[model samples]
Target chain A: MQRPYNFSAGPAAMPVEVLQQAAAEMLDWHGSGMSVMEMSHRGKEFMSIIETAEADLRELLAVPPNFRILFMQGGGLGENAIVPLNLSRGGVVDFVVTGSWSQKSFKEARKFCDPHLAASNEADCHTRLPAPGSWQLSPDAQYVHLCSNETIHGVELHELPDLKALGSNAPLVIDFSSHVASRTVDWRRVGLAFGGAQKNLGPAGVTLVVVREDLLGHALSICPSAFDYKTVADNGSMYNTPPTYGIYMAGLTFQWLKRQSEGNLRGIAAMEHRNMAKAELLYGFIDQSSFYVNKVATDCRSRMNVPFFLRDESRNEAFLAGAKAAGLLQLKGHKSVGGMRASLYNAMPLEGVQALVAYMRDFEQKLA
Target chain B: MQRPYNFSAGPAAMPVEVLQQAAAEMLDWHGSGMSVMEMSHRGKEFMSIIETAEADLRELLAVPPNFRILFMQGGGLGENAIVPLNLSRGGVVDFVVTGSWSQKSFKEARKFCDPHLAASNEADCHTRLPAPGSWQLSPDAQYVHLCSNETIHGVELHELPDLKALGSNAPLVIDFSSHVASRTVDWRRVGLAFGGAQKNLGPAGVTLVVVREDLLGHALSICPSAFDYKTVADNGSMYNTPPTYGIYMAGLTFQWLKRQSEGNLRGIAAMEHRNMAKAELLYGFIDQSSFYVNKVATDCRSRMNVPFFLRDESRNEAFLAGAKAAGLLQLKGHKSVGGMRASLYNAMPLEGVQALVAYMRDFEQKLA
Candidate 1:
């Protein structure tokens, strides 16, 4: 059966191969006589699963030796509180609010620490980035937080700001939920990076936290042991079960990632190239057409989530129905922002985007 | 192929029917073109899934009208601190320490509030529960905490203690991870109950929180919004993106539970009967033999997790291998307490228990 191209913002479409492999191994994983979900986290079979997953993710992302990868529960929202609980120590923290996610992070952190909005783009409907030069760096801030990619608003940070270069000694924390693994991470400028695995990784319920070695043991006394980054890192994410099945599927994805090749690039490098092509295919058609428009600035637009509005709003439901009939799914934008969002994650092949663009043109011609 | 009778404490074995249903629905759920994992949590499809799962569980447990069921992330370990974060209010709280899980709970709760040990069975290596009448209840205690079943020590509170009857005005909180769904809960005696789904329910990532309506709004300022019961309950477990696939599998298990019928009993009523029989089979066999022993008192022995020691400890490895060859898996006890634990949850059939007992007898005969 031909499945529609799933464009969900999260718990999103996984690679077809990953799903197939997972389904094949649903009852027994590699002759272990138990599904990965059924194996004890401490058992050797599951230990190997977690270890290989962590290793592959480290390799795919080129994670630094000085950083630790901890698999945790609680998606990005849970981390909004967990991050502050672990790092704040009741000190002031600065935030550069780019879009909804970082804005939510700042608000949630206020309950645990003194959160100061160092910069924001709410004045412009979050279409552009706040110039980094204008950020007010707090001298005593525990960390400066930002969302590298805004899943809802379709804003992406093409380059990370080095806090040291900005004359701030605080470690930079980025919520890279939507665009993780689609592009390279500048780890040197980051103290901690966290993302829910749903969007670009494998599934929900598994959260990935990459924290610098120096930031390890400063969790406040009130931090939950399972959410405590230090405890999780120390226990190898077995601090509490570690979402065994999700890790196994993600491990399969990482293995798939390692084998992804495009042009002169391979692995994540190849994935980034293919993602760029897919985004170019969809956005180029939108830019050249009179019937559709993308509001985000060219330089700051997200490659993963592309939100576009139809020239005639009355055609929305009809367009969605036609899109569904044509084998496209979950393209509806977030409720807070009404439009259409085509999230072309690492899983959406270039052909899928080409088909979408072709359908859009044919539909536009019919409307004309 | 015949599957093994797995005995891992948690991330434990599930009902085979649940696995089959999950596999069948791996691509499409009902007539929806998306897998449950692919559905938006707010969308109609996933909402129906959550509502059905909640309703089935409510029916199975006979939960009262005033209780709110919250499907959350972070396992029991996360709840160790989350419970105090939400209920402790930085006020005095009393804990009845019985075994490893409760001891960990007490230690983590100390980080959030002044958690005093009102009673303890540590003096007897957690072999017995302290007499309820002897506990020195704190007058201003926020709540009195206890593990209804100590998964590690194989001890259970066959009868829940009533705080009012014991001269305490505080509410009672129970962690019922290893035995939830296998028996019934007395909601009149519980203020809040939480457990990870890996054991009796479904998978590792989903944590079930059933809180009293009156206990909703008292979370400390230090609580993360995601872990805060009020925020979670109000949003219908979508304050954050939930573990979608985990919820789907749990929903399947709930259906399995609801359809269960044995003799004149049905559903959870039937589950309790089968659990009693399974526990009796294994324990009765162990009791009749000189080669094995279970230390917990017969009145307090866990119907779900039965921890037993071989008469000769030197043959432990050989016993495990023999059991594995006989299609009984993961019978080894927790590393902290070296012995064998056979957790016969709702998922384990009486025949599985009989198979385990037969294997145990065969191994003992061979050793002789």
Candidate 2:
């Protein structure tokens, strides 16, 4: 049976094969006589599962040797506070706000440190990115924060900026919740990168944190020990029970990623190539059509989340109802930003985007 | 096929039925065309899931209208810091350290509040609980904390102490991680009760917090908003994308708990009766056998986790190997406490305990 294509921003679609394998092994994982969910976190079975998951994720991302991959609970929003708690050290922190998520991070960090607005695309209504060279870097800033992809506003930083070249020696922190694994990350420019697994990873429960080695052990005294990077790293993210099932599912996803191939590309590279195609297909059609439009700047448009508006806003409900009828789901835009959004995450195949574009054309012609 | 009996301390064994149901619905939950893991937390499908789960759990626990049930991430250890950050107000908070879990809570709480040890079992090696009468309650203490069941030390507080009767009106905070659903809680005496779902509920990603309404809002400035009880309660734990799949699995476990029956008893009461029977059978055999011994005080011995040691210390490895061969897994005790621990959680059938006893008898005979 064909599954409906899902376009929700997060807790989104997973690879069908990964879900099937998880279902098949839910009762007894590799004849261990226990589901991955039922294994003790400290037991050899689960320890091996977590270790392999971390290692596979490392290989998939080519994470640097000095980076520590910490599997944690609480999504990107939770990390908003946890990051400042660990890195801010009650000092000045700079934020380059591109959209809603970075705005939230900046606001939340104010409770922990001196959060400075280094640059903001809010002046343009978050439809574009502020060039890195235009950013106002704090001379005493401990770190600079940005959201690489805004799931809601549909803006993405395709390339990470070199902070030293941008006249700041501070570490850069990126909230890559929506676009992680859909593309490559430049680790040399990143001090820490965190994302909720709900988008491109696997599920909602696990949050992935990859932090540079030197950034560890600097958590504020009030930081929850479970979320303390040094503590989490020291214990291999088992300082508390590390979202056992979520990690296992994400491991399956990492394995699925490894098996992916598109022409000469494989793994993350393959995903990036496919994601670009899917985004370009949908955006190309929208750009050509008179009935629908995406307003984000061409250079900063997100490949994962595509927010579009119909020329006549009265057709919004009808658009959603028709999309549902056409086996498309969750196309409604975020409540904060009214319209429609089609999130083309790593798992969303090119065929799904083609189907969406075809449906849009059909609807437009009918309306005309 | 017969599944092996598991005896791990936590992230322990679950009911075979729960695993089977989860597997069956993994790809498509109730024809929603989405796995529970993939459902948007705010979408109708997941809202129904969380609401039903909360309702069923409230029904099972007989939670009062004045108390709010929160589904959160961050296990019990995370709560160690969160509880104080929300409740302590940086004031003098009292702790009754029964064992390792409570001791850790006390230590973590010191970061957020002036933690005062009102009572401690450490001098006695955590083998017994310090009586309520012996506790030195502080006049200005904000709350008194204790682990109702020490998962590591195999001790339990069968009944919570009334702080009011002891001349202190501080709310009683119980970490019931190891035995939450095994029996009913006296909500009147409990201002708050929190536990990680991995023990009796389901998976490791979700933490359950049932707090009195009056205890709602007063979090420290440094508290992460996601971990703030007021924010969590006000948003019905949707402040951050909750551990969606974990909540769903835990909902399944709650449903399983509701379906359970024991003669005239049902639900939590039924599990309590069955748990008592299982505990008595295992402890009875151990007490009668000269080959093994359990060191915890008889009155406070945990019905869920029974830690015992063979008199012959050199045979620990052989004992574990034999137990594994007999399809009893993870019987090895906590690293801090070297002994075999058989946890008889709600899911463990009486037959599993009988099988364990029979294995123990055979092992003793072989040693002889």
Candidate 3:
């Protein structure tokens, strides 16, 4: 059966191959009598599954030796409070409000620590990234937080800000949920990075946290033992049953990613090149057309999520209906952002973009 | 292919029918052209999935209308702290420590509230339940906490203690992770009941929280918004990106549970009847045998988790190997309690228990 190209912002599209593999192994994973979901997390079968998943993710992302990859529950929002509870120590923390996600992070941080806004793109209605040099560096900040990519507003940070260069001695933390494996990460500049797996990764339920080793033991006395980074890391993400099925699915995704090759690039590097190409195709078509508008600044536009608006606001429902008829799905934008959004994650093929652009153009011409 | 009988405590076994259905729907669920994993939580497809799951569970458990069912992340361990943060209000809370799970719950709750030990079976090494009349219920306690089924030590509170009858004004909170859906719950006696889906429900990541409407608000100021019961209840468990896939899988399990029947009984009642029969068959066999012994008192023994030891400790390896050879897997006991454990959750059939008993009897004869 021909599956429609799903453009959901999250719980978004996944590689068809990943789904097929998971389906095939859903009953018995690799000759084990039990399904991945039914296996004990501490059992050797599942231990190998989690270990391989963590190792493959580390390799794919080029995660450093100094970092511990802890598989946790609670998505990015949960981490907003958990991060401060672990690292902030009720001290001053700097936040750059890029869009909805980072804005939330700043607010949740207020519960356990003193959060200071360093910069905000809300001044420009989140159409552009706030300049790193313009940020107000907190000299005594425990850590600086920012959303690397805004799924709703379609904003991306092409380059990470250097805290040391910005005259801040604090470690840098980024909520990279929307665009994690789509690009390479520079580990030297980041103290902690967290993302929900529902978007670019395999599935929801399992959260990925890559934190520097030095950041482990600073969790507050009130931190839940399950959410405490030190306990999770010390127990190898098995302090509790570590979302066994989610990890297994993610492991299969990592394997699929490893086999991906584009020219000389492989794995995440390959995904990065393909994602950029897909983004360029959609954005170029929109830029050349008078019927569509993408308001985000060109230099900072997200490569994963491309939010566009039809010139005629009256035609929004028709566009969605037509898009669905053409086998393109989940194109409606977030309620907060009134427009159409097409998330071109790692799994969104270049052909999917071509199909979406074709559908949009045909709809525009038909109305014209 | 014939599958083995798995006996892992939590994340133990599931109905074969559920696994088969999940595998079939992993690619395209109900012709939605997207896996349940790929559907947005707010989208109609997933909304229907969660809503149906919730409704079915409500029917199966006969949950009262005044209670709210929350689909959350972070397992039961996470809830140990979350329950206190939401209910304790930083005041005195009563805990009845029965075994490993309740012990952990007690320790984690200490971080947020003044935990008063109302009752304990630790002196008996968790071999029996503490009598309700003997409990030291605090007059000013905000809530009384206990584990309905202790997975590790093979102890269970068959009948929920009546806090009102005990002259405690506090509400009763029960952690029912290991035996949820296997038996009927007395909602009149329970203020809140929480469990992870890994054992009797579905997968590991999603947690089931049934909280009374009156207990909705009053989270500690330090509580993470994602973990706040009121916030989660208000958002329909979508204040953050919930464990979408886990919920979907659990929804399938609920449907599977609803179809279950035994003689004149149906659903949870049917499960209760079948579980009692299964437990009796295994326990009766153990009682008749000279080579095996179950430590927990018969009145307080868990129907789900039956922990037993061989007459000779030196034959533990031989027994496990022989059981494995006979298609009985993961029968080795928890490291904390050194003996074999057979967890007969709802998914475990009469045949599986019969197979386990047969293996034990044969192993005993061979050694003798």
Candidate 4:
């Protein structure tokens, strides 16, 4: 028997092994006689859980020695304010409005800093990413904000832009919420990276923040102590009681990711290989079929979230119903962009994408 | 078999039934072929879970229609700063510092408002609550902050202070993290009530905020859109991607709490009755035993957390080791104030209290 593939962009699908382990240990974790949720954050049991989770994540991402990984509570939306509050210094900051997530970050940063438009792909209807060389980098910008993958727009920056090469001395802050761990990150090009854990990492409550140690301690006075990177780092994200159960779930996910293997690849490298194949399979089918059309540019199409529209929109309801019957779930796209989307996160197997493509193909043939 | 009676306090013990149900539904929830963690917050399945949870909570608490219930992230510590950011209006806010939690809230509020220490029990080592008559009511205060139950010091406000009788119009804001849903609330006297869901609720990530409708739209400009009470209320706590799993776990716990019964009482009334019995059982044992002592004044002792000390501190290790061996776990006191502490949350059955009493009796006999 197979479980239906869930395609939620976030609070997204999780690996079956992770879910199995979580279910198996739901009552007691490692013979501790208490569930992960029941353990105090300050207790040795929970401390080990969080510490191991951090170490595993750091290893999984090959996080630099200078970087500190924090397990925080608020999602990517909360980090919009937190990032500016910590890094912006109430000074000029550059924003590349690539899509909805970055656009929201740019807008939210306005309250705390002077967010200057570095570049925008809005003119292209966010179907493409602005060329890195075209950004009007701010001379005195505290940081440059970008969403590495725009979940809604189905656009992703395959490679991070090097700020120093672009004549900006500022740090590059990326919100990689939808696509974190799907591919390797180039630390040299990134000063800080944050993501909500729902999509690729684990669950929704936990937000992962990996920042260069040098970027710490410059938080604005108004920044809440719990949200202050320095405070969180200082206390190891236990400044406030952390999301214990969520961290435990993420730890299980990290372990599962660690066990993943591909031909000549392991861990994140394997995930990247698998994700690339899944994306190619889905996007390849969509590009070839006359019934389907993906609006995003070829180079910028997100490997995680692939949004597409049916040529005949009237058949959308019947298509979705048939897909459900075929065990393909949550094919409905975001309301902001009314169509269909299939998120191929780290937990999404190639077989799931194959099934989706098959379902789409069947639906299209039935129409003929 | 009875599991170890865990008493670490917040992120404390959950109802076994909730854990069992969560485990059963880990792979697929109600035949949706998706775990609660995997469901999109906007999806019908998750929406139903959250809605039903809210409805049940309102019925259990008898919350007024005028007060909006918000499922938020960031624990009580985060709310220390958030409460002021939303409600203070940069004006003076009166704080009654009874213990560590309120004291922390008062200091955090300093960044957003002129936080006035209207009262403090630190002089008494937080062993007693300052009378309402003694509180210096700030004439132009925005709100009055207090921790209804001091988890660490084991002091609780048995009855809410009537600010009107005390000659103040400022709405009372209570941090009920350690005691929420364990007992009833008098909403008429409270303008806002916030608590981390780790204790009486379910998990660590979700924070519960119940605020009067009139208090909406007052967030400071610097408030993060996700943290803004108005924005969160408007979007129904989906302003940012909420802690979906935490909320689901809490929903499960809420359902479990709703099924509680004690004699003629049900729900919160049942919990209050059970909690009172558990507290009495432990406190009564401690008070009668010459070897053990609880410092807090009897009239103000916390019904949830009972902090006690042995006359001979040298036997602390032995006492703790014996307790753990006897299936009593996490009875160690907080590092800031050490000795021993037992938290009897709603899930802590009276039998668990009896076992603790039995352990204490046997330990005291060894000394004789």
True contacts kept of each: 0.68, 0.78, 0.85, 0.85
> Model 2 segments beyond 4 Å from truth?
none
For candidate 1, lDDT tens digit of each residue in A1-368?
77778788888888878877888788898998888889999999999999999999999999999999999989999999999989998899999999999999999998889999999999989999998999998999999999999999999999999899899999999999999999888898899999999988888889999999889888887778888788888899988877888888789989999999987898999999998889888889999999999999889999999999998988889888899898888888889999899999998888889879988999999989
- Across A12-97, the per-residue lDDT of candidate 4 in tens digits comes to 99999999999999999999999999998998899999999999999999999999999998899999999999999999999999
Candidate lDDT (C-alpha), each: 0.90, 0.94, 0.92, 0.94
lDDT tens readout by residue for model 2, A1-368: 78999888889999999999999999999999999988999988999999999999999999999999999988998999999999999999999999999999999998999999999999999999999999999999999999999999999999999999988999999999999999999999999999999999988989999999999999998788999999999999988888999999999999999999999999999999999999999999999999999999999999999999998999999999999989888899998999999999988899999999999999999999
DockQ of all predictions against the true structure, Cα-based: 0.76, 0.84, 0.88, 0.89
Against the true structure, what is every candidate's RMSD?
Answer: 1.2, 0.8, 0.8, 0.7
TM-score of the A chain in model 4:
0.99
Q: Mark the regions of model 1 whose C-alpha exceeds 4 Å error after superposition.
A: none
lDDT digits (tens) for residues B224-323 of candidate 2:
8899999998898999998899999999999999999989898999999999999999999999999999999999999999999999989999999989
C-alpha TM-score for every candidate: 0.98, 0.99, 0.99, 0.99
Worst 10 residues of 2 chain B by lDDT: B32-41
DockQ of candidate 2 is: 0.84
Q: After superposition, how far is residue A64 of candidate 2 from its true place, in Å?
A: 1.0
